[model samples]
Target: MSVVGCGYLGVTHAAGMAELGHRVIGVDVDAAKIATLAGGRSPFFEPGLDELIARHLANGRLRFTTSYEEAATADVHFICVGTPQLGDGTAADMRYLDAVVETLAPYLVKECLVVGKSTVPAGTAARITSMLRVLAPAGESISVAWNPEFLCEGKAVSDTLHPDRLVLGVPDEQAEKVLREVYAPIIDAGVPVVVADLPTAEVIKTAANSFTATKISFINAIAEFCEASGADVTVVSDALGYDARIGRQFLNSGLGFGGGCLPKDIRAFQARAHELGVGQSLAFLAEVDAVNLRCRERVVEYLRKQCGGAFTGRRIAVLGAAFKGGTDDVRDSPALYVANLISQQEGEVAVYDPQAIENARRAFPNLVYERGVLEAANGADAVAVLTDWPEFGTVDPDVLGEVVRSRNIVDARHALDPARWLRAGWNYIAPGRPALQPALVGTV
Candidate 1:
């Protein structure tokens, strides 16, 4: 099997396939990424990926290449390239997907199965099918399948190795047979499979992510009511989570979803809906998008109040830069957005993350970078924990309290205990939670 486009999705999937005892070739246009993977090193940060690459490359089950010849010889190919949101933020940019198909389709000289694992708008698989039929030397004999990836960034390795379910978008029985064999090891391990037609498979990913994003925005939108009514969002979510129908997966009432997938997927889904003339059906997603963006702005607003109504020359330490914990992906990171907002307002922002410092520095060159949380907090007026990394949740509040000029903490991701920070001589502020009213900031 060949896993094309070795970014977060492809690299992990390649390593995962090799782990399941398949000879897998990792392909990418980026020479550096190919080199890094070929040498058993992951170019990006994902938990346990380096170990997987090392183990597989040692056993010769995994390899990396930039040539299309390596991919053409494989019996199955997985298209896992990025489908980023368009520049205008109106639709998904399919240029990368198109380029991959254009480059690889001509090399198909046999009956090979082309599986697409990227999160794309509905009908993308059908479009790719049309392109392959026209371009492939193998003609209409080759099969194209849609198998959208369900891997999460931080837990990507595990997610691929032990998926809850497998969804295959197949054009015919042959496509399904090819996919079943490609994933035989996983199926033997008891992972259920859901088979559907081409277009349905395409919608599954977009629809799933849209619903998850909506759940996140739903809780965030309700948390606003909690803020206005002096209610505790934690308690509200805790009770709401008791209903089996409403699980507690993305229910945390904090800075909303932002990563490579969720934000862009929801927007792309909306755009596709609009294109299909059902725009009004998923219209609430616009609010979900707005609410997600507003969470970051609200953090900025809270910081403004914490700064006594001015941001100029104020010192703020922001903890966490990746969109969420466990991965170094900074695309559309809310933490970086909030930090950039504060810095733009003339605040002295020192940002730190456990694993995302390098990527964050590259993404936001103007923001100050620090090595450790305490270093970022040093001499700052307040600290905002934005990305929900576990370390930030467990960091000693007293130590951070001593580092900052004012013991003010904004738990933007709801990742810290307000009682702990307050007891440690710090003012705890968070969205959807009561702020550090002067009455509540008295000595413990």
Candidate 2:
């Protein structure tokens, strides 16, 4: 078996497959990335992937290369390339997926199953089938399948080695058999397999992400109304979360959803719906995007207000830069976006994250990067917890207060403990909750 396109998804999948006892060849177009994997290290930052790559490489089950010819011997191929949002920011760019299938097609000299792990439109399998049938030397021997992955970034290794379920979109019985054989270890260990036609498997991935995004936006949109009525959304969200019908997963009432998947998947789903002439079906997604964007704006405005209605000279500390905790990917990250917005307002901003500082620096070179949380918080007029890193939640407010010039804190991610900050004589503010301001200097 082989895993092609060794980015986040591909590398993790390749490692997981090798761990499952398959002789896996990992392929990528980038020579530098191939070299990194070949040397038993990961090119990116995922918690447990480097260890897996090293263990598998030493055991002789995993290897990487930049050429497609080297992977031609494997009859089972997993296409794990990314489908990023296009330049227009509305539709998915299928160029990488196209290139993978085209490049691998001519090398199909024997019978093979070209399994797609990348998220794509509903009818993409049929188009690829046509392409493979025309391009491959073995013609109909090349079977097309869609096996969309649902691994979260931070917990990718665990998610892959033990997924909730394995989805297989097969054209015929033979394709299903090949997939079941490929994932036999997982299947034997009791992971449910959802076998369906090509289109259903494709749509399931997008549908799941859209629903999760909606829940996040629903709570955030409610947070907006809570601000108007002086109602605390945190309490309201907790109350609603108790109902089994509306559980408390993505109901955090903070900076909504970002990272590689939710943002682009929602937009791409909308674009696909429009192309199918049912644009109105997913119109609410546009609002979801709006509410998520507004959360960033709310943070910027809160910081500006903390600066006495002027952001020109405020020394603001922004914590966390990855879209969320657990991964260093800053693509469409809310924390990084807000930091950039503050910098644009001419505010002195210092940003810090445990794993995302370097990534954030590459994305926005002008913003101040801090080695530690205290460095960012030191001598600041106000501190805003933008990304909900567990460390941000656990950092002692009393210690944080000692370094800052003022005791103003706004928990944009609602990550910090307001009670702890208030007790330390700091004015604590958070979205959807009343301000827990500390006592005045003379009042005590």
Candidate 3:
């Protein structure tokens, strides 16, 4: 089997397939990335992925290359390229998807299945099928399917190896049979597989992302009400999570969703819906996107308030630059966005992340990057924990207090224990939560 586009999705999928005992060829247009993977190194940060790739590469089951010709003889080809949002509009840029199909189609000289795992707008699979029909030398012998991926950033390795469910979009029994054989190990382990047509499969990923984004924004909207009502959004979210129908996932109300997936996926979903003439059906997604962005601005305003109502001449320490924890990806990161917002206001910002500082530095070059949390917090007027990294939550407020000029901290993600910080003589604040004053000496 061959996986086209050696990115987050492609690299993980290729290594995962090899772990399932299938010989895998990973292809990418970037020679540098290929060289990195060919030498058993991952270009990006994903927990357990580097080890998995190195294990497979060492065992001879996995290999990477820049040439599509090396992938020509594979029985199955998975399209795992990225479909980022277009620069001009909210619509997805499909050039990468198109290039993959056009470049790999002519190499299909034998009966093979070309499966798409990239998250794309609906009806893309059928269009790719048509392209392959015309471009492939084997003509009708080539089969196209959509097997949308559901891997999360931090937990991608676990998600790939032990998926809760698999959605396979295939035209016929043969394509299904081929995919079933490809994933027999997972299916045999009792993971349910939902077989649908091309368009339905394509809709599944965007729909899932949109729904998750809506869930996150819904709680954020409630958090806005909580702020006005003097109610704790955390308690409200806890109460709401008690309902089985509501559940607790994506219900946290601090900083709203942002990353490579949810932010762009919802916008792209809305754009695609507009193109299909059902724009009004998903109109609320526009508000969902707005609510998520507003979370960033809300944090900026809170930081300004912490800095005595202005950002000028303020030194702010921002902990966690990744959108969320456990990944180095900073694309559309809310934490980075808020940091940039503060920096734009002339705040001296010191940003730190366990894994994302390099990526964050590249994304926001003007902001100061720190190697560790303590270093970022050193001499800071205020500290803001934006991303929910576990280390940020466990940092001792008293220890952090020793190095800062002031004892002001904003728990933007609700990551720190407010009672602990307040007890340590630090004024703590969070979104949708009341600003609590530091405990007086000798007070319980």
Candidate 4:
């Protein structure tokens, strides 16, 4: 089996396929990524990926290359390229997926099944299948299948090893049999597998992501109301969670959803719905987008309010930059959005993160980057915990309180304890919860 485009998904797929005893060749157009993987190093920070890559390297089952010909000859080719959101931020840019299909078309020898593992708008598999049939030497016989990836970044390896369900989109019976054989190891391992038509499989991925994003935005919207009405969103979500109908997965309300998958997938789904003349049906996703975008603004506002005035001349320290913790992907990161807002207001903002600083620096070169949490908080008026990293809870509030000019803390992720900051004689604030009021002047 071959995995094309060795980004996060490609690397993970390659490692897993090789672990399943298939000789895997990972193909990528990027020389740097190829070189990195060839040396048995993972290009990104995924738990267990480097070790898995090294293990596969030792077994000689996994190889990395920049050649499409090496990839095209594989019995089953998994196209795992990225389809980022279009410039307008609505449609999906299928350029990468399209290029991979075109590159692998000429070398198709027999009845090969090219499985798509990237998240794309519904009906994309059908379009690509048509294109491949026109391009490949075995045009009439070459098959395409859609098997979209459902794994989140942080838990990708585990998710792949033990997926909740597998959706295979195949056009014909022969294609289904080939894919079933390809995933036979996983099927034997007892993971739920579903085989459906190409269009339905494509829809499954977009729909699943959109639903997850909608659930997140739903709680965020409720959290806004919870803040206004003196109610706890955590409690509300907890109670709502007890009902089996509204299972608690994406219902945690904090900083809004932002990553490679959730945000872009929803927008692409909405864009596709519009293109298919169902624009009115998906209008609520526009609200979901608005709700998600609004949460970032609310964080900026909460920080400004805690600072006791304008953001023009305050030294604010921001913690965390990856969209969520555990990965270095900074695509559409909410923490960076919060930091950018503070910096744009002419405030002195210092940013720090465990793993995402380099990507954050490339995204926001104008903002000041800090080497550690202490340096980010040094001499600042307020400190905002933007991303919920595990190490963040270990940072001593008392020490940070000593360096900051104002002992005002905004825990945007609701990460740190509100009472602990107050015990340290600092004012603490969090969204969807009441802020601990500042002590009256000259009062013990």
Candidate 5:
């Protein structure tokens, strides 16, 4: 089997197939990335990724390459190239996916399945099928199938190994049988598997991301209302989750959604819906986008209130930069958004994260990068916990209190223990919950 585009998804799929005892070839255009994978190290930070790659490399089941011909010669090919949102923020740039199709078409001799794992616009699978039919060598059989991946970045390996569901869009029964056999491991594991037409599978991936993005923005919209009225959003969200229809998974009412998937997916969906003349049906998504943007502003407002309506000279510290913890990707990171806004203030802004500091530095060169938690918190009038790193839970509140000049903590991610911080005499504020003002709450 061959996996093209060896970033997060490509490397992961390659390692996963190798773990299942298949001989896998990983291909990418970037020479450095190929070198890194060939050296038995993941270029990015993901738990268990290096060990898995190293194990596969040691056994010789996996190899890295910069050639499309190498990957196209395999029994099956999976295209994992990125479909980044276009500049207009509505359509996906299909250049990479198109390039992959164009490159692999000539190499086909026998029947082969070119499975698409990238999240693409609706109708993309059929479009690619037509392209493949046009580009493949004469009399060579080629089938294009849509097999969108649902792996989250941090737990990508486990998610791929045991996905919640598998949706395969095949043209006919024969294609369906082949796809099922290809995914026999996951299918036998009792993962909910759905076989549908090409367009349906394409829509499934975009729609799911759009829904998750909308759900997150929905709670954040309420958080705006909670700010105006004296209602605790956490309690309201908890109450709403009691209904069986509304399960409490992505009901988080914090800094809203920002990462590689949610923001771009919704925009692309909205764009596609407009093109299909169903724009009014998804108009609510625009509100979701607005509500999400507003959450960031509210955090800045809260920080101003903490610093006596000014941050001209008060030192502020920002903790965490990755959009979410467990990955080093800083694309559209909420933490960086907040850090950039805070850094604009006359006060010094120190930023720290266990994994994302380098990526954060690249995106936010103006912000002061701190080496340790104490360095970030030291002499700061207020410290904001922007990303919810699990390590944040273990940091001693009393020690942090001693480092900061002022014990005012804004728990933007709602991750830290407010009571512990209050006991240490720090004023703790969080989104969606009533402020844990140290003066009001007992310091026990």
Candidate 6:
């Protein structure tokens, strides 16, 4: 089996396939990235991915190369390249997908199934299928399939090996048979498989992401109303969770969704919808995107008030930089966005995260970074917990109180217990929640 692209998705998928007892070759254009994986190390931080790659590499089941030629002999080729959003518009840039198909087409010397695991707009597989028929040497023998990946950054390994469901988008029984054989281990484990045509499988991923984004933004919108009506959003979420129809997932009202996936996926989905001439059906996604962005600004507004109405000459400590916890991916991170906003307003912003400091530092170099939580909070006029890392939730508020010049804290993610901070002689605040004053000294 061959996996194209050695990024987060590619590396995890390759390592996982190797672990499942198949020889896997991970191909990438970047020599440095290939070298990193060849050395049994993941280029970026994903929980358990490094160890998985190391185990597979030691056993000789997994190897990496910068050349596409190495992938020619494989019976199955999985296109795992990314489709990041275009800079000029909301539509996805399909250049990576195009490059993989064009570059690998000439190497198709035998019957093989070319499976696409990347999230793309509907009809992408049909277009790629047409390209392969024209470009491949073994035109009639080549086949295409869409097997979209449903992976969470922190849980990529587990998700890949033990997926709840498998979606196979194929043109015929031959393609379906080939994919079923490839994922036999997962299928054998009772994981349900949904077989469909090319476009359905392609739209599944985008639709899922868009719906998740809407749920997140929907709760955030309700949080806004909760604030105006003096209702607690957390309690409201708890009540909403009681209804089976509205199970608690992506319902936390915080600095809303941002990562390599959700933000760009929703925009690309909307863009594709418009291109399909049924844009009105998904028009609400535009508001979903807007509400998510507004959460960042609202957090900044909360922090500014905590800074005594201005950011100038204030020292602010920002905890957590990764968009969400459990991974070191800082693409479109809300924590960094808010931190940069404070820095731009002349506040001395000190940022810290358990694992994302390096990536965050590279992304936002102007913001001061610290080695530890206390270091970032030291002499800070106020502190803001933007990302929902467990470390921030468990930190001793009293100890943190000892370092800050003022004990003003905003739980922008609603991750901390307001009672804990208020009891520790600090003023605590959060969106859609009333401000709470510190408990009297010597009182529990």
Could you say which candidate leads in lDDT?
Answer: 6
Model 5, residue 355: C-alpha shift (Å): 0.6
Cα error, candidate 3, residue 42 (Å): 0.8
lDDT per model vs. reference: 0.89, 0.89, 0.90, 0.86, 0.85, 0.90
Clashing pairs for model 3 are none
- lDDT by residue for model 6 over 70-121, one digit each (tens)? 7889999999999999999999999999999999999898999999999999
Could you give candidate 5's per-residue lDDT for residues 1-67 as a string of tens digits?
8998897888998898898778999989999989999999999988888999999999999999998
Runs of candidate 6 exceeding 4 Å displacement: 435-444
Q: Which digits, one per residue and each the tens of the lDDT, describe model 1 over residues 193-237?
A: 999998898898888998999999899988777777677788889
Candidate 2 C-alpha lDDT tens digits along 1-444: 999999889999999999999999999989998998999999888999999999999999999998899898898999999999999768999999999989988898999899999999889999999999999898888899999999999999999989999999999999999889888989999999999999999999999999999999899888777776667788898899999999988899887788999999999999999999999999999998898888888767777767777778889999989998988999999988888888888988999999988889999999999999899999999998988889889989889989998888889888877777788887787777743422211111
Residue pairs in clash, model 5 = none
TM-score of each: 0.97, 0.96, 0.97, 0.96, 0.95, 0.97
User: Considering only N, C-alpha and C atoms within 3 Å, which residue pairs clash in candidate 4?
Assistant: none
Q: Which stretches of candidate 2 lie over 4 Å from their true place?
A: 435-444
Which stretch of 10 consecutive residues in model 1 shows the poorest summed lDDT? 435-444
lDDT of 3 by residue, 3-65 (tens): 999988899999999999999999999999999999899999999999999999999999999
Provide the clashing-pair count of each candidate structure.
Answer: 0, 0, 0, 0, 0, 0
> Could you give the candidate ranking by lDDT, starting with the highest?
6, 3, 1, 2, 4, 5
Candidate 4: residue 294 Cα off by (Å): 0.4
| Shift in Å, residue 83, candidate 1 | 0.6
Q: After superposition, how far is residue 225 of candidate 3 from its true place, in Å?
A: 0.6
Model 3 residue runs over 4 Å out of place are 435-444
Q: On a 0 to 100 scale, what is the lDDT of residue 243 in model 2?
A: 96
